[model samples]
Each structure stands twice: as C-alpha cells, then as structure tokens.
Target: MKTLYRYISLELVKTATTAFFLFLFVILINRASQIAETILGQGVSFLDFFSILLKMLPAFFGIVIPIALIISITMVFLSMESNNEITALKSCGVSIKQISVPVIILGVVASAISFYSTMYLAPKSNVEVKRDIERLVKKKLTMSITPKNFSSNFPGIIFYVEKIFPQKGIIEDFMVSIQKKDKLITIFGKEGNLRTENDTVFLDILNGSAQILNWKKPKDFQFLTFKNYTVELFKFSSEERFNARKYQTLSQLLKEKNVESQTEILKRLCLSLSPLIVGILIFSIAVSLPRGAFGTGISLTLLTIVIYYVLYTFSKRLAFGLKLPEIALLPDILFGALSGLLYYLSIKEKLKIHTGARW
Candidate 1:
C-alpha cells in the first residue's frame, strides 16, 4: 500500500508540474504582444521588464495550478481505468475510497498553494506591478515632450514649445495653457527647465508672465510677471493614495468593512478552495467512468473546468451586483454536492456488482 501510494503521488506530481509550466508558457505567449506594447513601447529597461514579469507569476500560478491539477487527475485516472488497473485493484479488495486517498491528499496540497498565492502573493505583486508601471509612465512622460507641436498628455494643461534642448532639459519659447473650473490661466516663458521630484513633474519657467481671465467676467483679467515660476506638469499617485481592492493583501481586506471588501474577501477564499472542490469532483467523475473511456474522460475534464469557471464568474458578479457576499460560495457548494453524489453512486455501483468485475 505504501509503494502504491508513493507511485501514484509521484506520478501526479510530475504530470501536474509539467502541465502547470506548459499552461503558463502558453498564456505568456498569448499575451506577448500586449506585454511588449506596454513595456517595450514605453522604453522601459529590459531588466525592469523582466522584473515585472517575475512579479506577475504569483497571479498566474493562482489561476493555472488548479487547472493543472484537474488535468493531471483526469489523465492519470483515465489511463489507469483504460488499462484495467482500477479493476485489478478492486478485485484485490481495494475499494474506490481507498484508491482515492492519494488524490485527496494531492488536492489538499494544491489547495494550500492556491491559497497562499491568491490571498497574499498575488495581491502584493499586483501592487508592485501597478507601482512599476506608474513609475515607467512618469519616466516616459518626462522625456517625451515634443517640441514644435502642441502636447496635451497631461490633464488640464497643454504645452507648446518652439524648441527643446534634450541634453540640457531646457525649452525655448514655452507657452502653457491651464484650464480651470471658472477661469483660464496662461503662461509665457522665454526659457523653461523640466525636473522630476518624487511623483511630480516641475517646470521652472524663467522670465515668465501669467495672464488670468475669469470665465464668467471676461473683462476681469489679471496679469503678473516673475523671474522664475514653477508649474507642476504631472503628478502620479503616491503609495498612500494607491489603494484598490485588487492591490490589498488578505489582512488589509479583513480590516476593512465595506461591501466591496467583503465581497473580495469571500471571492478570494472561494477561489483558494476551488482546487480541492473541483479536484474531488473530477476524481469522482474519473473513477465512475467505464473502461476504455479515455476520450470521454478528457472531454469531461475540459467541460468541467469551463463550467466551474463560468459559474464562479457569474456568482461573483451576482454577489457584487446584489451586494450579497455569500453568493460567492455558490459554485463551491454546488460542485461539492455534486462530488458527494457522484462518489456515493460510484461506490453503490461497485457494491451492486459484488464480484469485483469491470463495469
């Protein structure tokens, strides 16, 4: 029994590992174009791009591990059943429940990994990825201001530069228009230098004059002149301001009291348990198949995965729309009940035969 268990567990582990990497590679290839456009087009360094991809792995693992487990379970059990190995075991008094021990253990292990990635690593990496992208955007914007054309990349501000000295970060004949709620503020500078500090872009204009006109009263205009005037061109969010539900850790989500947070918490927990829930369900389905049902088993595996994800997504949307966090557990509850029913039927079918013969 020990040898049998070790053999089964090792086979499962090897197959799942291969499937996990294969699925992950396929996903990365599918998204290669989008990733290149986002990272390379922004002129980000290769090292930084690689770092971002590494940071994204936890989220990918959370998605692909469960899939790999399901595929591995289906493949292994189907092969065994096709070869009449399950029948041979049953003839020797090995019950279906006893044969399922290895699968149940593997399910628990996979669930633990999924839990860690979804609850902690994925959220932390999400935050880091957002910060990295924001930093890269700021870097690109600072160097991308084109001369001889009107630039409106920054919100509420437009820049028109007659000439730019890229090496010195200086602009000549700089004109900027600032739109306000009830007024228009324009500045004209003979020369301006650009600098970035923290999350803000500062343009220090030399020998500049400002003209302000109230929108409601065009006749009420104000004018001022200065040797040096600083205009904040762009500002990115700081760490304190970078708060989103997807970017929060499990602990952070638990501390918050709100509909979105509660919904997110339940969603994460349900997703984490999905592997075990779906694993048992798939295992029961696999064991109940007749001999030489290899193609059917594979088809059922794919269909089950699709159905589970569709139901999960629908339940999550329904939960959020209805503001009922408990709805997030619907998929797990339904699948779990199905697993129990299938297991019972499989065992009862074996009992009815009473001769340990292949069905």
Candidate 2:
C-alpha cells in the first residue's frame, strides 16, 4: 500500500506541476502586453519589468493552483485507467476508496497551499502591485495623460491633453473638468507639468482659466484666470491611508464589522478550502478504462470545473454584491456532498462513473 500510494502521489504531483506551469505560461503571455504598456513610457528598465513580474506572481498563483489541480488529477487518473493501472490495483484487492487515499492526501496538501496564497500572499501582492503602478504614474505624471483621451487619474476629476511629452512630464492644450456636488468646474490651461515635494503629487498648470457652472441656475456662473494653478493629485507617505476590500489582510478583515469585511472574509476562506473540495469532487469521476468519450474523465473534469466555477461565481456575487453573505459556503458544501455521493454510487455500480443520464 505504501508503494502504491507513493507511485500515485508522485504521478499526481508531477502532472499537477506540469499543468500549473502551462497555465502560468499562458496567463503570463496574455498579461505581458499590459505590463509592457504600463511601463512603456515610464523610464523603466528591463530589470524593473522583471521585478514587476515577480511582484505580480503571488496574485496569479492564488487563482491558478486550484484550476491546475483539477486538470492534473483528471489527466493522471484517466491516463492510469487507460494504461490498465487501476485495473491492476483492483485485481490486487484494492477497493476504489483505498486507491483514492493518495489523491485525498494530495488534496489536503493542495488545500494548505491554496490557503496560504489566498489568505496572505495574494492580498499582499495585490497591494504591492497597486503601489508599484501608482509609483510609476507618479514618476512621470504625464505618462498617464494621453492626448485625445480623457484621464481620470485624479479622484472625481477627468482631464484631456491635446499633446503630451511623457519623458519631460509636460502637457499642452490641457483641460480638466470636475463635478463638485451640483456644480461643474472646468479648467483650461495653455501648459501643465507635475511637481513633487515631500512625496506629494501636485499638478501645476500655467495660464489656466476656470469656469464654475451651477446646474440649478443657468445664469449663476463664475469665471477666473490664473498665471499658475496648483492641484494636489496625491500624497504618498507613511501617513497616507490605503484601504480597499481586496487590499486587506485576513487580520484586518476580521477586525472590521461591515458588509465588505464579511463578504471578503467568507469569500477568501471558502476559496482557501476550494482545492480540497474541488479535488475530491473531480477525483470521484475517475473509473476503469473509459467507454467512448463520455467516460474518458478529462471531459468530465472540464465539465466539473465549469460547473464549479459557475456556482463559485454565483456564490461570490450573492455574498459580495447582493448582501447575502450566508450562501458563500453553499457551493463548497454542495459539491462536497455531491462528490461523496457519486463516489459511493461508482463503487456500487463498478466502472460506471459517468452519471450524465441521471443528471
């Protein structure tokens, strides 16, 4: 039994590693362009780009591991069955449940990994990524202000520049508009630049004109002109407060008593347990040598993943968006019970794991 367990466990690990890298590679390729565009005109070096990639990895791992586990287990178990390995084990007095012991252990290990990534690493990396990108924007404020496009880089304000020099942090034909609670304030400037002093960002506009319009009264309007105008963009120091639902750690979430905190806590926790739940659920679909495409197990794995993702997304939406936080664990519990039942049914029927007819 130890030898058999070792063999099965090793195979699962090997296949899971391969699948994880393949998924990671594809995701990296998909996102590479966005990262390039981020630092394209920001005076960034190749080494800086690599640093940004490493900083973004934790968040990616949190999302990718559970997905790869489903694919890996399905491929490994299906391959073993196709090669008559499961049949050989059965002839040696191994029950289906006994043969599942190694997979169950693997599930537990993967669950630990998922918990670590989601609970601490992912959130930390997310915060770092935000800070890093924000730093890039600050380094060259003009980089974010593209000509012919409106930029809402400042809170509650949007601006457009007819021309911009990102390297020199200069803009020409600048116009910014802001809505201040029942009034619209518009500013037009001949030129603009950024000023940084004591880690504070300020937009310095030259020869700018301003107009204030009252929505309630068409004639109640004001106009002004200035040789120089200064607007605070942001302040980045130890005193600066950064707070968001996804940017918080587990401890911070526990300390808060609000809908956002509740939703995030439940969501993160349930995601942490998803690996074990999804792993066992997917493992139950494996049986003897497949009969046609229906029993191949890989397609069943994909189907299970899709179904779980649907339920997972629905649960998240209900909990986070709809104020129904109690249902966050519904998918995990429901799918776990379903997996257990299917395993029992498979053992009784013997080699008939595909239950599409019943569903």
Candidate 3:
C-alpha cells in the first residue's frame, strides 16, 4: 500500500509539474507580442522587460496551478482506467478510497500554493510590476515624447512641441491644452525645460502665454503673459497610485471595510480553495466513468474549467454591481455541492460493484 501510494503520488507530481510549466509557457507565448509592444515600445531595456515578466509569474501561478492540477488528475486517472489498471487494483482489493488518497494530498498542496500566490505573492508582484513600469516610463519619458506630435499620456492634458532636444532636456515651441470642469486652459511657450523632482514631473515654460476660455460663456475669455510658468505633468505617489485593490496585500485588504474589499476577500478565499474542490470532483468523475470514456473525460475537464471561471466572473460582477459581498461565494458553493453529490454516487457505485463480485 505504501509503495502504491508513493508511485501514484510521484506520477501525479511529475505530470502536474510538467503541465504547469507547459501551460505557463503557452500563455506567455500567446501574450508575447502584447508584452513586447508594452515594454519594448517604451524603450525599456531587455533586462527590465524580463524582470517584469518574472514579477508577473505570481499572478499566473494563482490561476495556472489549479488548472494544471485538474488536468493532471483527469489525465492520470483516465489513463489508468483506460489501461484497465484501475480494474486490476480494484480486483486486488485496493478500494477507490485508497486510490483517492494521493489525489487528495496533491490537491491540498496545490491549494496551499494557490492560496499563497493569490493572497500574498500576487498582490506584492502587482505593486512591484506597476512601480517598475512607472519607473521605466519616467526614465524613458523624453525619448517617448515625439516632436510635433501631440501626446496625451498625461491625464487631462495634451501637449505638443515643435522641436525636442532629449539630451539637453529642452523643448522649443511647447504648447499645452488642459480641460477643466468649466473652462479650457491653454499655455504656449517659446522654450521649456523638462525636469523631475521625486515622484513628480514638471515642465517649466519660458516666455509663455496662458489663455482661459469659459465653457458656459464663450465670450468670457482671459489671457495672461508670464516670463516663466510651471506645469505639473503628473505624480506617482504611493498613496494615490497604489490604492487599487490589486496592489494591496492580504493584511492591507483585511483592514479595509467596504463592499469591494469584502468582495475581494471572499473571491480570493474561494479561488484558493478551488483546486481541492475541482480535484475531488474530477477524481470522482474519473473513477465512476466507463473504461472507454477518455474523450468524455477531457471534454468534461474543459467544460468544468469553463463553467467554473464563467460562474466565478459572473458572481464577482453581480456582487460588485449589487454591493453584496456574499454573491461572490456562489460559484464555490455550487461546485462544492456538485462535487459532494458526484463523490457520493461514485462511492455507492464502487460499493455495489464490490458486493456483486462477492456474491
């Protein structure tokens, strides 16, 4: 029994590890072009691009580990059933419960990994990735801004320059338009210098003129001239930038009291436990199905993944839309109940088979 358990566990671990990396690689390849455009297009170095990719793994792990576990369990058990190995084990008095032990153990481990990734590592990585990208953007800002092209990278402001000397951090014929709630503010300068102080980027315009036009009264317009004027392009402060839920850690999320935070907490917990729920469900289905059900098993696995994620996404949207955090638990509850029912039926079938053989 020990040897059998070890053999099964080893096979499961090997297959699952392989599948996990393979799936991750395929997903990275699928997103390669988009990632390249985002990073390389920004003129970020290759090292920085690779670093961002590495930081992104935790987010992928939270999603990919459970998927790999389910696929591995289905493939292993279905292969065993197809080759009559399950029947041979059963004939030797090895019960379905015994066969399930390895799967349960693997599920627990995978669930732990998923929990860590989602609750801790993923959030931390998200913040780091954001910070890194922000840093790269700030570093490459001069290079990214094209002369004679109006750039809207800064929120609520559009700026154009007739000429730019990136090395000298100087601009000629700098023009900026800013939209306000009640009016439009436009600034023009013959020369300007770009500089950064801490987290803020500032443009100091020389010999500039400002024009303000009121939206409510088209005839009401104000114009002013100045020797020097400064415009704050943007800021990257942590308090304002990192306030999103995705950038928050588990402890940080726990301290917040709001509908979104509560929903996020529930969603993370449910996602963490999904692997065990899905593993048991697939295991029961694998054991109960007929020998020649390999195609059915694969189909079922794919369908289960699709259904689970769809339900999860819908529940999250419903929860946020209705401001009810409990709605987020719907997917896990439904899947948990279905898993229990299928497990019961599989055990009953095994018991009946044993009794008939004895008779």
Candidate 4:
C-alpha cells in the first residue's frame, strides 16, 4: 500500500510539473512577442522589457497554475487506469478513497499558494509595475525631443528645428505654432532649448519671432520676435489613489468592509477554494475509469477538465453579477459534492450490491 501510494504521488507530481512548464513557456512566448514590438518602437533594450515581464509573473502564475494542476492530475490518473494499475490495486483490496489521500493533501497546498499570490504578491507587483512604467514614460519624454522631426507635444502646437546642440543646450531654425478660437500664432527662432526647474519644464527660444492670424480681421497678421521666450511643458497626470479592488490583499478581502466590497472579497476567497474541489473531482473521475485503452481514459479525463472549468467560470460570473455573498465557495461545494456522489457510485459498483443483495 505504501509503495502504491508513493508511486501514484510521484506520477501526479511529474505530470503537474510537466504541465506547468509547458503552459508557462507558451505564456512567456506570447508576452515576448508583445514586448518585442514595444521595445523596438521605444528604442529600449530587451533586458528592460524582460525585467518588466518577470515582475508580472506572480499574477500570471496565480491563474495558470490552478488550471495546469487540474489538467495534469486528470491526465495522470487516466494514464494509470489505462495501464490496468488501478484494476490491480482494486483486486488487492485497496479502495479508491484510500488512493485519493495524497491528491487531497496536494490540493490543500495548491489552494494556500493561490490565495497568497492573488492577495499579496499580485497586488504588490501591480503597484510597483505601474510606477516603473510611469517613470520610464517621463524619462523617454525628456530624452526624445530633438530637432529634424516635427513634434506635436501639445496638440495644436507644433515645433520644428533645423539644428540642435543638445550638450550645449541650443537649437537653431526653430518654429512654434499655437492655434486657438479664430486665431493662429506662429513663432520662429534662430536658437531654442529646453529648461527644467523646481519640477516645472520650460521650452526657451532665443531670438524667436511670433505671428498671429485673426479670422475676424481680414488683414490682421500680428507678428512679434523676442530675445528669449519660454513655454510651460505639457504636464503628465498624477497617479490616482489605489482602489479597494486594485491593491487589496486576500486578508483584507476576508475582512469584508462594506456591502459591495464584501461580495468581491467573498468571490476572491472562493477562487482560492477551487483547487481543493478540483482535486477531489479528479479522484472521483480517476476511480471511475475502467480497465481500458489509453484513448478511452484520456478522452474521459479531457471531458472532466472541460466540465470543471465551465462550472468554475459560470460560478465566478454569478458571484460577480448577482451580489452573491460568500459565493466563491459555491463552485467548490458543487464540484466537491459531485465528487462525493461519484465516489459513492464507485463504491457501489465495486461491492456489486443492488437494492436486493444476496447474503
């Protein structure tokens, strides 16, 4: 019995690990493709993009690991059944319930990990990643403004320059335009440059000329030139405060502050419970597999995974839309009960006892 239990546990672990890496590779590839485009356009190194993706992995794992575990367990059990090992065990009087003990233990561990990622690691990474991106954008904005290409920093305002000595802080053949209600203004300069002071950005033009065209006056072409002219930099919006859902951890969700928040919290908690339910469901399906060909067992395993995912998704939607309090447990309970029913049915079949049994 010990050997058999060890064998089963080992097989499940192998299957789970294989599934995790396979799916994780696929995820990384997809993310890499998107990152490639972003880096190429922004002239950023691949290393920087990879760093951002690495930081995002906790959230990704929170979703992928659960699905991988479910499918892997199903596949492992079905494979064992197809090989007749389960039949041999049964003949030796080792019950299906006994075989399921290790899977249940694994299920509990996975659930705890899921809860930690969703509540803690995920939110922390999200906040930090946002700050990182914001900093990158500001840096890029400062470094990118140069002469030769037309820049539309502020809409309805255009900047053009023929030559720029960035190190010396000077520009030549510079032009600036501003358009407003019934008026168009244009400025030209022999030199211009950028200035930053006290958290304010300014564009200073030297020896520049401005022209205004007013629609109301048919002959109005007002023009002005100055030794030095400055325009305020376009301001970036400040980061907003963290909302209840965005940064709240699982522990906070369990506290359930208000009516709406309570529902959300319950929904999140229920998602954490799904792994246990799925593990039990896998056991029930595994025990039901008859001594069969590989195709038969694998097909049934796939079907069980599909059914479980459908039920989980449906319950999650109901939790979110219907204001179902503590509704997260609903899917877990439903699947767990189904597992119990299947186990009981398996026992009935093994005993070969019906309504009228011969003593």
Clashes of each: 0, 0, 0, 0
- Which pairs of residues collide in model 2? none
All predictions: root-mean-square deviation over Cα?
Answer: 5.2, 3.4, 4.6, 7.3
Note the Cα lDDT for every prediction shown.
0.82, 0.78, 0.84, 0.68
Give the higher-TM-score candidate: 1 or 3: 3
Report the lDDT tens digits of candidate 2 across residue range 17-106: 998999888887777788887577666667767777778888877668888887778887877776677778778889888888887788
Best by lDDT: 3
The deviation in Å at residue 14 for candidate 2 is: 0.9
Worst 10 residues of 3 by lDDT: 350-359
Ranking by TM-score: 2, 3, 1, 4
Estimated TM-score for each candidate: 0.80, 0.88, 0.84, 0.70
Candidate 1: stretches off by over 4 Å: 142-195, 203-230, 237-239, 350-359
Give the Å shift of residue 259 in candidate 4.
3.0
1 or 2: which has the higher TM-score?
2
Local error of candidate 4 at residue 213 (angstroms): 16
Pairs in clash, predicted candidate 1:
none
Clashes (candidate 2): 0
